[model samples]
Target: MKNSNLFKITLLFSAITLSISTANASKIDNDEFTSLQYLDKVTTDAFVEENKNKEFYDVIVGIEDDQLATALLTNDRMRKALEVGESFMYKGQEYVKTEHLLNVADQFRQDIKSMLGYDFHVVQTFNDIYQVLVTTDGSEEKEDVLKNLIQTGKFTYVQENEQMQLMGYDNEGDNKPMSVVNPSITNDRHYAEQVYFARQVDGYEGAASIEVAKQILSDRGVFASENKVNVHVLDGGMVPHEDLDYAEAVDFKYRNHQGKATDDGVIWVKKDFTREDDQYVSPAFDCSGFSSDPESENATSWRPDPPPEDEADEWYRYDTNKGLSLNSLHGLQAAGIIAAKSGNGVGISGIIPQENVNLVSALVVDKCSGGSADIMKAVYWSIDNLESPYAIGNSSYDGLPYERTQYPADVINMSFGGGNAMCFKRSNNYWTTAWTQVVQDADEKGTVLISSAGNETTTTFNVSPAGCENVMSVGAIYENGRPTGFTNFGDSIDVMAMGSKVWSTSGEVVDAGEFDVGYGPVNGTSFSGPIVAGLAGLLKLADDNLTPKQVVDLIKNGAKPLDVGFSGGETTCGWLGCGAGAVNFENSVRILLDGEILGEPKATHYLADHKQKDDSNYISLQSEFNPNLCSTYKVYGSVMNDKYEDLEYTLYGQVGSGDYEVVKVTNNSNFTFNKEHDNYQLSACNATTGNCSRNVNVELDSSYSPAACG
Candidate 1:
């Protein structure tokens, strides 16, 4: 408890930008309180008595810098956690030299045994920290040992490891049943109708958007090539799914994660996925000393017995699933949405039908949940093994993207989100969390980050990665055209997609975990987010040079307005609104292809979304969304009509509620205001022209009077 240098450690933690979390995150109850008595015992007595039990606890050790990181890599108190090394990514570097690592690993353990009478070994290492599994005497709590160690001031933070659960649920849906399958729905040529959003977009005016995108791409000779896009699915391993084709994998279990998972210290692999003898040896699989888990069992084959009376445990067996495991179903279902086989007439269609997308599966989160550290490792692996002109990733779960991975990520889809957890918070330098900073770093690299608005039926800011700046957060809409009942909304969500009762392949359907098989229906912002991801892949495919900023614009502006919320009420289109509305799948692609030709309204012209009113004589013009009468602005004898009067802006103010009717903004609306009342909202439209912008609330430096606006 003597943390004399705690202040220094805190400052040092902030200065080093490796994106590690130092939150005092673990919780302990009094039942474990008795262990502290052992702290006063001889170091030898603690070690000898603890070693007698031969049980080891997984330990997380936090250090100060890369130098300490490098030292820990060679420290004895740390031993390789798993017998065999799984690929390890720390501070954005990969550690695969097993012989060297394990050799030094042994030496470090011996040194700790001699110096401190503690039998411990390293399981994982990062540039700024390392993990070791240590045996503790019954007298001292594992948490107590970690706590006292932190007090020595040699570390930034320490705590017991945390566990994760899969983020999935049975849809119990009726709209898109699992039992029925039609050839047209399954056929690649006619499967668009089976997909809720793949066909016609409700919000965008052009109903033929998808068909138009296909035709335009075809005319340009742009075809679907599995070789083109790289999509990483960081979930349970992709089981042997039939509808999903061309999936590559990197087993992220074992390695530093040790006892938490079934760690055989081996990454699993498949022949077709790792075909070296074939002409196009897919550059997708990880061959860098990393392999796959043994293999996963077909969930369809193992029907759990009828008796809840016979066993008191919950489990399922699989070859690759480490026996009774929460194997690859959720991961597979997500993959199906992105790249299921098309035109085979056996299963439901994926979003990018006809295009064989390269799916690089990283089993980062086993079952449904996993830690940020494991996710960081998988991201590094993907950056290394799957970088052909770069790629995008699909995270059906929520976690921060790594700030700096060895490779580039073009677009990352986080289809999962919720309120803040122990793992991330701005007070914890939320941005510095490797999970958060990585996305920001990816953004700098032009990697567009996409997240779910959440399913909490609340504002998205309550969520983490979604509310993080610059992410394309998505919400959900039901099949009947209502916003999904549980979808979280607010300005954080950029668009919506068909999420309720949409059919796709089921990973658990195959008897032997093979492809070309099972199908079912699902619901969630999870599905909505991926549909956007699939579209994003298409955007990158159509034009790889699309910047992250441009991607956000195309997605938001091209969407059709929903005009309603999950509660059957009209939606207020503002900073607290559900964004620009639902995803217009076809209009999105069309907008991308049309580029500047469309001359859509620009957000740039309406500066001051964050304009400081404290010093301004007159604040800059307010924002307005205008659809020109002509392709360009119409010119009649060099005179433009003041058409905006027909549709006016309603300005909401600092109170966060109530509306103020604003004068129609033609080009820009500038108003001189008292700094005291600078906080106000603004919105505009050309109702006659059927074009409008969402209501925007601006917080000026101060306040305003009615006369100031005129």
Candidate 2:
């Protein structure tokens, strides 16, 4: 009987060994699994060594399946992988959908206790992914704990949460507040100060092209406001400002400050104050706890504070600098550029002048710095929160109440970026995988992601999320259309826009009286990013069903060539260096709506020596006409001569294929001719040099107008 039992046990063991070999062979043959193995071989050891000594590490753990995560948490094998610790703390809200996991939550906790001897908590949870902040009081190294977690083969990847920087900068020696009033087509107070709203002398069509596109849409009876588009600006906190309209504003900063209170029941107010019960009453503070402060009884206000210098200074109740509050300046400026209130005779006009585009400020950055984990959380939240405009739902998740808009973001403007090299398929590191996943997920949800190409003025191949796939990277250009000295460039850039001296609503508070308001000029690719994001919002407003790829393609195809090359003096921007060129909102819109390119008007004239003249008396007569005023269009011709005075000239006009007709004859230096045809050509010539001005073609339609023709 014993011999028979031994033979049966041998057969059972052989069957188990065969099953294990088959599973390993299958995984090895799989391309994706093989790639993961290769990545593990190179990056695992280096990552563990690099982060071993930190006080604590916030690591993003990605799991291939939600079931696997639950199983790993309760698995006995996983509990034996590492030594148990004494104690630890986990913070942040967790969203989970598995009921079985909830039932086994105690088991999972016990398992964690046995594995790391620390309290394990889920900080935040994605669909099948989550983040955890690990701390241990035991002898085992934190990095070793992470290595053991990786060795368990339960997570898809694990990497430290990195940080990203805001991509804007103040011009060297030009940081003063903007005071110049340059007039634009709009009646807003600072409309003229927005240089991107008008064409530059160097032929760079600025964001002003959007105005023409708006007109075209209006003529077609397709108004932008009727089809509202939501744009989420993922940046620093947004203070209450007059110029910007927010669909929803969320403060993701840590809620650790203690509320200020007095014995008489006055609470500290961080926002604007109002009158109540015959007295000026401020909003109730939403803080952790109140402290009795008799000295602040009469002072029931809170001021904006500067960034902390160290960990000890991070927690504060009020402004210590007593200077301008730069808390939300970057975010406010970006929001202003995208969808500031327009035509209200307010501060300035946004790309979309009306209230059609909804702006959501996802405050992921603290002051000007933000971690990768928080950014990814905000992005995922935005994606999941996309719902019908009329459907009422709770949009708050992190203990903040934010109203649910018509939808999530049709386009997310990330005016911040960091890191070197493309984020995907380059290193296969944990951070790269997480970033790539977020960007890809956004794309899958039809949300176009746009980011600044950075201000490093070097190859953008090293900058991300700009270098990441599915992200439309933007570079900065001067008002004259040349690439900014500090704007990063390379194959990663999708387009360029006006970034130098661009004026928008500022977020600085000069004094306590001026609570949440200001306007000024700032420089950097940071501003350039929102300009394109505004354009994307308009594109979605024009056609709510357009895919993210289509929107990017249309923008690229409609872009105009830059005034200069990426390196300067090169005539045009190369495809890999400066993208498809400068963004032309009008042309992009026209191409989408009309399926054709309506070229802008052009006229060229130069002085040349004539054989019959001894003193080079070349007369060049240039005519200027307003193409926007249809039916009452008039061309005013002016003559310039080297020697001749009051030169006589004749203006000729041809309608379609008709013969040239004398539209005007004058001996004076200036003459005017009324346009009488929808399509016509005009030229001016004098008998002196027998030279004629270059012919200018004027095309007028209900939706096609160039504003000016020369």
Candidate 3:
């Protein structure tokens, strides 16, 4: 067996050593409450030992008085600083010892046990702030302990930890089967002819054969990488489905980064604000161990409880006939839509072809609802620690968790969101419900964050991340191009996509222990969010240098403009937050590849009446300039391109029973098209390479003929 294999075997045995007891409360030592001397320990080995044993108390204390830091360093109440000197990688981030707790003025003169009756030790110190480990026999309630700490004037605030939750529903009662629409899925009564959105486009639907990469890159010569671009997927356990690439699934929570011969895997670290134990495999590692399945070989081994206690979390209400294991179902569905193995002759294709979008599980959702602290850790780990930096990040979680950590990913997809669900129990109000500031910081880092407009049928302006500026919020539409009643729409949403009953890879829930591999259709903005994320991947692949702003512009500009009835027709300021309409994958790619000039060429008829062109109004052929009664007409073309890049433009005109003639070439201004023309087309070509853009026929209104605007 391999060295890593040996580590796993050792881990297997080590796991058996730790377990979670169902004892009602924190274990209390029946012995008399005795305190250990804080000043007696100046050595690091004993400090490491006590941390591993969980014999220390972890607490975060913010000193209101700046001088308290100096005073605390001299005061002999808490353990002295370990003063780590070197920088090392932990969960993917470099924690420089030089930056760790440098500004300490004094140590607490009063022993925590003597004054507050709680044992305390320093896990980490940053300047005046100290993240201390708190420990006791377990007789006192955590609430009461925190209360006592807050009562002391020495500390500005008490410490508390938070976590994040998966946005999709969580239930185990009965997972009914959902409908799946796939061309390859046959011999099933439940199967139906899938109406794919690709077929709705002009060139895509009419194409006879299915040719990928070539069809996508369009003779660009470079074959799109068969390997998918990896992104961070922070959610519950990762179930290795046939559609999923098992090799890419990672559990950062239990990843062993230390070299060979080192057993670094730990059972579980309490969600406390402390570094009590850095060693897990050693006897010094503080872990409840194998009690739950977080350390199991199978990632999904730790499933959610059949019925969660928090009924307010409506993750249980939604289900379908497609028998999906409620355990980690939502994350799988969203991930599948984004990167499920495509065109293998078994399942439907993803927006970004086959396995070209690799998903790295951040594993934030531990069980049911995730804690805020883990989410922040996952984000930091993904952005800083991943072996391969992710190009995109997907968060299909709704409701609130905790913390406001920055996620500087290239592209982030938030499929899950709610209007406003604040936790009254938590001290943080709306901040606990969403990572609003994090998204803003991500935007600053050039991370294009795309989010669903929510399925609540309300305005998205109030939804977090979505509501946050710089986030491309998307609403959902049906196969027929009509806005779904469930999608939240407003002036804030940037674009729309097909979200109703989309088909993708999923885990078939069975009575047996594990889920069988299969495919199905799921509804809601959750699935729609991936469609946009997948599009972002395609855009990035086309132009590796595309920025978040540029990608948003292309995706939004390429959208097939739609009008939502519920929001009262199009607004004068442009379509409300609902945006340009349904997203056109072909158009989006075309914009990226061809630089946006597959647009219809427009013609302005210079009638004998001396008509002129103006922005207030316009005219076109068939309505203003008829072949039978034609006058001089000025033809204009449009193409999006970098101003610095040398480009040439040509206007093509076809007269009645005549072939198209090049009316003009490389003309920056309007061309006087004085001819009895029937139709017109525009072409943009690379000035030096002689390569020309695809021909674009101008679209003209029937009621209004081509005429010059007054």
Candidate 3 C-alpha lDDT tens digits along 538-591: 766666577777788777766665553436655321444567666666666655
Q: Give the TM-score of candidate 1.
A: 0.56
Q: On a 0 to 100 scale, what is the lDDT of residue 284 in model 1?
A: 29
lDDT of each: 0.46, 0.56, 0.47
Ranked candidates (TM-score, high to low) = 2, 1, 3
Runs with alpha carbons beyond 4 Å of true place in candidate 3: 1-196, 201-214, 222-228, 252-326, 385-410, 418-437, 440-447, 509-513, 564-576, 598-639, 643-683, 686-710
Q: Write the per-residue lDDT of candidate 2 for residues 27-101, one digit (tens) a residue.
A: 233455333222222121122222223233455677655554543231111122212221111122232324344
Question: Model 2: residues >4 Å from true position, as ranges?
Answer: 1-54, 65-68, 71-121, 135-152, 175-183, 200-208, 255-326, 385-406, 420-422, 426-432, 510-516, 563-576, 597-710
Candidate 1's error at 263, in angstroms? 11
- Range of the 10 consecutive residues with the lowest summed lDDT in candidate 3: 390-399
User: Relative to the unseen true structure, what is the C-alpha lDDT of residue 484 in candidate 3, on a scale of 0 to 100?
Assistant: 65
